[model samples]
Each structure stands twice: as C-alpha cells, then as structure tokens.
Target: MAELLAPASCPLCLGGDNRFYHQDKVRCYWHCAHCALVFADPGSHLAADAELAIYRQHENNPQDSRYRAFLNKLAAPLSQRLGTTGLTGLDFGCGPGPTLSLMLQEAGQQMAVFDPYFANEPEVLQQQYDFICCTEAIEHFYQPAKEWALWLTLLKAGGWLGLMTKLAPTQDEFARWHYKNDPTHVCFFSRETFLFLAERDGFTVEFIGNDVILLHKKALS
Candidate 1:
C-alpha cells in the first residue's frame, strides 16, 4: 500500500515540491510554496481531444466586439509599452478564431499566431519576437516549466510578455471559485507566483487591472 501511494508531484514543481491545497467535487489541487502556484491533479486533466472539444466551443473570433474589448485589457497596456508601431508580436495562444492577433495587427504591430490546436505553426515557435501575449491560456498548462522556458526562448532581449488569466483567489475562496471549475484550467498563479517567475527568470512584472500581467525581459547592453 505504501509503494502504491507514492508522493504526488505537482506539475509546476520541478522537485515535486508541493503541499495539498484544496479539493472540490471535480478535482484536487496542490500549492507550491516556492512559487505559490496552485495546480490541479494530473489525473483530473482533460485529454487532448476532450480539451479541444471545449476550446472549439469558444466564440473567440474577430467579429465579436465583447471579445475584442476583453483582449484590449492586455493589448492596450502592451501597445503603450511598445510605444512605437510596426514591432513584431506573437499571440502565443490565439484560440480557435484568433482575434487578438488581428486587433494588434490593426494597431500596427506585425503579428504571428500559434495555437496548439488551431494554428500550429512550427516555424513561428522557432523565432523570437518583440512581444508575446498569452491570454487566458497559461492556466491550461500541464507542464508549465517547459512552456515558460519556451516563451523565454521565443522572446527577444528587452521583449514584453503579456498575460491575461484570472489570478488565484485566497485559500478560503478556492473551493467556491468558478475559474477552477473548468476542467481545462489546471494551473493557477497569484501575484507571488508570478513574482517568483520574474525574480528567478530575469524579468520585471507588473499587474494590470484584475487579470492582466506584463513581464519585461532584461535588455542586451
């Protein structure tokens, strides 16, 4: 029985560093003390096809005014940071319809898009960009370390990375949170968690509004 019940490793924790966080009707969660990342049990994750089915239902097209406004939360800040037009960008996870890329393009940024399910352009992943925006997508990461490494590799020196995901609420509210109810949402980040990324990985972080986070990479001298 002891052998059967091995230590459970948190997906975001490299050394399996974690503590039991919370549980709901659907799944269990783990909290990493080092980064303050709340992650779901891997056993509860949706398979690729199942996850794709859920994504397929999102109406994230260019025609949706509401979606454009939501994206503007991150885009507006990022546009201001860029300060100039014609900079290159990558919509790290543009979802099914790819509207944010279109929005930034309209703002005068050259944009490339990559979505594991919808726009799987291998070429884009091989290149670095002036900025990268990943909205409402990091929560679905099962192997967040690898993804983080990839993002760093794909960003130019002094580049900006913008993210828009609902931050994890307090432990008291964890069970009642609607964001965690989604089967695809496996990883959650707090301000502390993001700060850990910035301090450890060489970047500066700023929170915008309730959900948007901006990280600026160190520039080459």
Candidate 2:
C-alpha cells in the first residue's frame, strides 16, 4: 500500500495529515481535509519528457472553430468580467496552439502567453497583467502551491485569474471518473477546495460553470 508513507501534505494548501482516498493499479489518491483537494501521490507523477510527449499529441489550433467555441466558455465570461477592452492579459498555461490569446485579443485585450514546455516565455511572466487565464493546466501541476503563488504575483491588484478544469467528482463517482484516467493529471480540485483557497489567500472566487472558475485578487490596502 502506497499509504504506508501516507502522512502526506496537501500540495495546494500545505495542510498536513492527508489520508488515503482511493487507489487504482496506477497510483494512490489522497484526500485533504483542510482544502478538499484530492491529489495523486508525487511518486506517481510522470517524468518531464513523458508529460511533454503527451501534450505534443494534442491538435488544438487557434483557427479551429470548434476549439475557439470551446474556449469561449472561459474567454467570453472573462471578457465580461473585465468589463472593458484594451486591458493587458496573460494566458498563463496556453498549450501548443495558443487559441485563447487570439480569442481574448478579438475581445479587445492585448494578450501574452507563457508555458513551461511550449511557449516558455519567462520574460513575459516577469510582467504583471490585468488578468490571467489558465485552462486545463492546473490539473497537471506537481507543485500547485508554488504555481498559485506565481499566478498571484503575475496578476495586478483586483485582477482576475480564470481557470478551466474538470472539477473532481463526488467521492462515489471518483473511481470511474474519466478525468482521472489521464495519467498527466495529478491535482484534483473540488469547489470546496477553491473556496478554501479564496478565503485563505484573499481572493474572491466565482464558479462560472461546471469547470470555469473566476477568482479576483484583493487590491492592496
């Protein structure tokens, strides 16, 4: 049993004493009482090359109408939240094709992008922005707390951090969840987890839909 080394900390909240939740032949999933984030054991994470290879197989493209329509789930709502045009934004984890940046640009915002594997624009990350959107990427985080901290720094005061991911299923449904079948996915977030984050980290969060989350950073006092 992998839980033999079970006294694991919640990667997102740094909460201690996470207990065993479930296990498949592949990996062990642990439940965090403090933040409600269910995550896989770090020992189960794939190597960098293996993860990158999987992502490279994706065919997402900026010109694909279906892909653009899909991204509108996050883009349209974020544009509405920004409530105006000409704002600067960053597409924090844009995968290879980079469609969201174009979508937001059409909505009248200037957009930049940074991805550790695909875009890798570290200089862009150094600049603050009015908003940042990370779609379907948070699930792959190995060090979620560090990633969250970096996003906070990249966002200007009162800025929005939009995200899209398949929120974790109820405990009963987790075993059969297709989302968990993706080997690259490590961190699983439930609505309660985001709520805990908003209260602890000083952000106001809104659940846009099943998967879209809009979190606003508190302006400095």
Candidate 3:
C-alpha cells in the first residue's frame, strides 16, 4: 500500500492542516484547514509536456463568438470598475491562443500575454501591471504557493485580479467530475478557498460564476 504523505495543510494559509478532505487510488483532495481549497496531491500529477499537449488540443481562437461572450461575463464588470482610463493588464497563462487578452485590448485596456506553452516571453514577466486575468488557468499551477505570491507582487497597488474555474461541488461529485478528468487540472478552489486566499493575500474576492472570481487589492486611498 502507498503510504499517505503527512497531513496536508492549506497552501493559502499554511497555518491549518487539512482534515476534512478525501482521496482514492488515482487522486486525493484535502480540505484546507485554513483557506478551504481542496487540491490534488502534488506527487500524483502529469508531466509538463504531457499536460501542455492536452491543453494544446483545446480549440482556443481569439475570434470565437461564444468564447468572447463567456469572457465578457467577467470582462464587462471588471471593465466597468476600471472607468475610462486605459490600464495595462496581464493575461497569465494565455494558452496556445489568447482570446481574453484580445478582448481586454478591444475594451481599451493595454494587454500583455504570457503562456508557458504558447507565448512564453521572458520580458512579459519583467513588467508590473495594473491588472491581471487568469481564466481557466490557476487550476494547472504546479506551484500554487510560489505562482500566487509572484502574481500578487506583479500587480500594482489597487489592481484587480480576475480568475475563472469551476468550483468543486462535493467530494462524491468530484470522483466523477469531468473537469478533473482533464490531466492538466490539479488545483481546485471553492468560494471559501477564494475568500481565504483573498484575505491572506490582502485582496477582496467576489464570485461571478461557479467558476469566476474577482480579487482586488485593498484600496490605497
């Protein structure tokens, strides 16, 4: 039998250990005692190249109407909050084809794109931004702790961070969840998780959909 690793702690809080989560032969999710995020065991995951290949199969086109509409659900509201000033934004994990950055650019926000598998430009990571969006991307992070810290540091004071990912419903449903079936998706977040993350990261969180969340830095003024 595979010996279980030490009790997992909430990656967001690092204070509370997971005690209420479950697991199986293929994967296990643990409820974060501090932040409430139920994530997969890092030891059990796919390789980077293999994961990228899975993502590459996605037909992501900048001009896809339905895709644009789905993104607008988050973009429209975030855009409204920004007012008329053209702010710079970063689209983290833009994937093989970046559509959200295009949409934001069309909305008058100057956008920069970055993707580990697609647009892996080193310079894009050097500049800070007024805002950042990570649609359907956070779930793939192998280093959630490091990546999140870097993301927070990259945002200018009072900037917005938008994220979209399907929230986990129940542990039972998680067993059959098609979203988890995707080899690239490993990290999972719940509303409690987002709230915990926001508070810990010094931002405020708003839920837009089962899969959409907006986190804003505390107002400086």
Candidate 4:
C-alpha cells in the first residue's frame, strides 16, 4: 500500500502546514493556519484553455448599468484617494470589456489595462503606475505570491493596490460556499489573509468594504 502524502503548503505565505477545510464533488479546499487563507488544491484548477473559455463567456459589457455600478464600488473610493487629474493607473486583469478602467478614465485618471487572455498587453506590466486595480481577479491566481510581488513591483512608491473579490467565509460555512465551486478560482483570501500580507510586506492595508481592499505602499523617505 502507498503511504499518504502531506497536506499542501499555503501558496500565499509559503506556510508549510495546512488543514483540510472543505471538499466538494469537484475539488478539495485547505485552510492555512498562518495566514488564514482558504485555497483549492492547484491540481483541481482548470486548464488555461478551459479557463479562457469561461472568461470569454462573461458578459462584461462596459455599458451595462448594473455592471458599471458593481465596478463603481472600487473605482469611486480609489479615485477619491488618487485626488487629482492625470494620475496614471493600471487595471490589472481587466476582463473582456474592462468597465472599471473606463469608469476611472472618466473620473480623470489615465488608465491602462492588462489581461493575459483579453488585453494581453505585456508593455503595461513593464511600467510602474500610481495605482493598480484588480477587481475580481486575485482568487484566480495560481501563484498568489509571485503575482502579488509583481503587482507590488509595478506600483510606484505611495501607490495604491485595490482589489475586489468575495472574502472566504467561516470554516463551517466553507462546505457550501459558492465561490469555491469555480474551478478557475484556485486561491482564496480572507480579511485576515490580507492583513497578514500587509504586515509581511509593510503595506498599509484598509478594508474598504466586504469585497474591497486597498493596500498602500509607503513613499520613500
């Protein structure tokens, strides 16, 4: 008989230990004690082609009023912090239609967008920005640590990194949580996970809403 393997390490914080959190017919989830992030085992994540197919089916119309309102939740607050015209920002992982970038542009922020499947603009990632918005994208990260480090590098000093994703629920609630059902969503973050990241990286973190978070990079002295 083969011996059982150990639980996977936490991807976000590189914590070597984790506990089984939840499992459905399709995927198993784990909880990181060190960072409080609940995540799906990467083996269960969808292939790139399958993931792109699902993303292509999204009705991310920029003109959709309801969708615009949903994006405004992050844009409004981020713009308030930006405070002045001509600030440059990047909408990291802006999906097919990219309504959030449009909303920020109308508010006098100059914006660029990068989506691996849709926009696929490599040059955008090459430049630093005053702020970066990543709405509904962090959960899909297969390697949260690398992706986050790149985002932090692409941000100028005193820059803002805004994120919007549904936070994970209590451990007891995980078995039935709908967010875990998405095969593309490999990593999940809670408020505690964000706080852990902020403390680890020296960024000032703020929870703007139930689904929104902002991490501010301190300016160089």
Candidate 5:
C-alpha cells in the first residue's frame, strides 16, 4: 500500500516531496509541504477516454441562466478589471460548450477558446493574449506546474490570468469535502498555494471571490 500512495512528486510545484494527507477506499491524497497544495495520487486519475466521456456529458449551455450565473463569478470581476473596450482573451480549457467564451464575447471581448479535448487549437496556445480566463479547469490539471508556466508564457506582459477552482479545505474539513470526490480533480489548491506561486512566478495574486482568483503578470522593469 505504500507504493500505491506514493505519487512521484507534487504536480503543482514539481517537488519530489509530500506528506500523506487523506485516503479513502478509492483514492489517497498528498500535501506538498513546499507549496501547500493538496493533490491526489496520480494512480487515481481517470483514463483519458473516460475523462473525455465525462466531459461530453456536461450541459454547459451558454443560454442556461444558472450556468451563466456560475461563470459570472469569474467573468464579472475580470470584466470590471478589463473594462469595456478592445479586450482580447483566451478561454483556456473551455470544455465542450465554451459558454464562458460566449459570455465574454457578448460583453465585447474578443475571446479564443481552447481545450485539450474540445477545442484543440494549438495556434491559439501560440498567441499572446491581454487576459486569459480558466474557469472550472485548474483542478483538472495533471501537470499543474507545466500548465501554469504555459499560461504565464501565453499572457502578454502585465496580462491577467483569471481562474476559478474551489480551495482545498483544512485537515478537519477534508474528510467531508465533496470537491475531492471528482475523479477528474487531481490537484487542489488553497490561498497559501496561490500566494506561493505568486511569489515564485512574479505574479500579484488577488482573491476576487471564494472560488475565483486573479493573477496579474508583473510588468517588465
């Protein structure tokens, strides 16, 4: 069982270090002491085919008021920061429907959508954007450090990276947390984890909401 619980490293910080955090009959969790990220063992991740199947079942309709409202938690705050004008952004990991992209477009922002499974557009990844919105996606990252580096590279200097993911709970709250139950959610982050990344990556982190954060890329000197 030791071998089963041993994840090679913390996917978020690339530290070959972590302490056992939690476990159930199905999956085990780890806590990265360096970055304060709680992640599930890699062996617990779902197969690519199965993951895509689950994504395909999502009803992320842009017309759904409830869904739009959920996305507004990130969109509204990001829009306020960007203002109403010629804003260009990327909707990273936009799932199958790309509702967030539509919402931003309606608010007069030119948005590009990309998802490894849905909108696999490599060219979009190659372009630099004024801002990037990654709603409901960060938790699904398998190699979070690599993905985060890519986001920093894709943004123009002084650009914004808006993300939406539920923060990890305290040790006492972990057992009852429902977010970890999702097989697709591998890496879980807390405010401390975000602050660590911000300090390391030269970003200015702001918690716009309980589940929303905005990381501003520092302008070059």
Candidate 6:
C-alpha cells in the first residue's frame, strides 16, 4: 500500500495541513480537516503554458445557440432563484474567452472575470461579489482548499455560487475515464462530496444536472 501523506494544511480550510488518506496512479487526494474538500497536490498539475494550451482547445461561444442553451441549464435556474439581487459576480476560471459571464451579463447581471491563463486579474480577486460562477473549473483545482474558501469569501451573504463539472464516478470506472486523463484536470468531485461541503458550510445546494450545481448561501447550514 502507498503511504498516505500529511498536507501542510488542508487546502480549503487553512485550519491545518490535513492528511491525505487516498491515492491512485497519478494523484493523491487530501481531505481537509475543516472542509470536506478532497484535493490533489498543486505540484501534480500541468505547467501554466500547457494548461493554457489545453483551455485553448475549448469552444465556449456565446453566439453558439446550442452552447448557450447548454449553459442556460445552469444560468436560467440560478437567475430565477437569485432574482434581482444587484449583486456583482466573479466568474472564477473564465477560460480563454468568457462566455458564461457574457450570458450572465445578457441576463442583466454584473460580473467580473478571472482565469489564471486567460483573464489573470489578481485585482478582481480583491473585490467581492454577490455571486460566483466556477463552471467546469473546479475539476482543475490543484489547490481546492485554498481556492474554494477564497471563492466563498468573494460572495456576499445569501449569494449564490454556481458550478458545472462532471461528478467523479466509482474507482472501477475512474481508472478508464477520459475526464481523469486530462493533464489539466487534477481534482475530481462527486455529488455527495459537494453536498457534504455545502452542508458543512451554511450553503444550500441544488443539482441542476449531473454536471451542474447551484448553491445558495441561505441553504448553508
């Protein structure tokens, strides 16, 4: 058996470096003592340039009606739930071109965009938002403990946080899953894992689809 290692601190909580009790061929996942987020090590990730090239292959176009319709699966419901909060939002990891922020803007919501590769605006991280969107981005988190808590801080109380990423399946299938093969994808989350996090925090969560989850602060308990 591979020896489990202790993280310097839980990636999400910063409470303390938690121990990683799980591992596989390519990665080790650490469970945060404070938050239940299991994350891969940052050192295990692909280089920034390589990660950028991978993102460049994505086709996220606001003009693409099908894609818009696909995004609406998350956008429409979240908008309906949030109503007119007048809360500005940050789209974490908005990729090379930010279509999700565009969709939110089209819905008459204000949003700031940020991505390590595409829109690396560290300044945006300073200001908080009414809500935050991390679509298809969480799986790429090499440091979930830190990034997620910061994302939580960015949202105002009672604000919504939306995410879209494929849930990790059982280990039997994960070994052969293509989603796990992406060099840029380091972290994997299951619906149960997300629900656990939300429940631990004060947020309430609604799964819009197998790939989308909408979290409202009100539900955080």
Candidate 2 lDDT tens digits, 1-221: 42257645789988896988888889888999999999998999999999999999999988899999889999988888899999999997899999999889988999998899999968998889999999999999998999999987889999999999999999889999999989999999999999999998899999977899999999989
Clashing pairs in 3: none
TM-score of each: 0.95, 0.96, 0.90, 0.95, 0.96, 0.81
Candidate 1 residues 116-183, lDDT tens each?
88899899998889999999999999898888989989999999999999999999998888999899
Instruction: Rank the candidate models, highest lDDT first.
Output: 2, 5, 1, 4, 3, 6
The residue-by-residue lDDT of candidate 4 on 36-60, one tens digit each, is 9888877787889999999988899
lDDT of 6 at 19: 59
Model 1, global lDDT: 0.88
Off by over 4 Å in 3: 1-3, 7-12
List per-prediction Cα lDDT, in the order shown.
0.88, 0.91, 0.81, 0.87, 0.90, 0.77
Of the candidates shown, which would achieve the greatest lDDT relative to the real structure?
Answer: 2
On lDDT, the stronger of 1 and 5 is: 5
Tell me how candidate 5 scores on lDDT: 0.90
User: For model 5, what is the alpha-carbon lDDT of residue 40?
Assistant: 88
Model 6 deviation from the true structure expressed as Cα RMSD, one decimal place: 3.4
lDDT by residue (42-160, candidate 3, tens digit) is 67788888887788799988888998888888788888877765899999998888999999898888999988788989798898899999999888886578778888788988999
How do these models rank on TM-score, best leading?
Answer: 2, 5, 1, 4, 3, 6
Model 1: residues >4 Å from true position, as ranges? 1-8
Hey, what RMSD does candidate 2 come out at? 1.2
